[model samples]
Target: MADPKPALVLHLATGGEPLLFALTTEESGKLAGKLTQLVKAGAVETVTTKDHQEVAINFAHVAAAYLDDLTRKTTVFGMR
Candidate 1:
């Protein structure tokens, strides 16, 4: 069997840049921590639960401001 792909939420900025984040099965505390760090570093706009299987992180706060980086990382993780 193949490894299960992680679910993701893609956050976008007004300029259309994306900030991809992996969805966790457990509580979002860890993810939240990482997001907080990212936000402090200006690497994300906001982090919020979109649904049971989704977490959104806006890209306005991203320092790199590149959706391609998010795409690359997501592809590597087998997330579409």
Candidate 2:
């Protein structure tokens, strides 16, 4: 078997503040590209998570990010 693709998460931040999302790598890349384009075109005013916390976007005062190597493992509920 080939090496598995690295897991990813998207982190949205403004002025060093952050909000995180456990999205798949593909989803993370696509959203990052979309955000960049929208930021360039001034199409995105606000970004939010499933929980509805807003992410403030600023092209000049913003940073890009992604989290990788976040592996998953199976667990049983009453097992220590």
Best by TM-score: 2
Per-model TM-score on C-alpha atoms: 0.27, 0.33
lDDT of 2 by residue, 30-70 (tens): 56656655545545345443354555544443344343433
Return the clash pairs for model 1, or none.
none
Q: Which ranges of candidate 1 are over 4 A from the true structure?
A: 1-14, 17-22, 43-80
Candidate 1's error at 2, in angstroms?
A: 24
Instruction: Name every residue pair that clashes in candidate 2.
Output: none
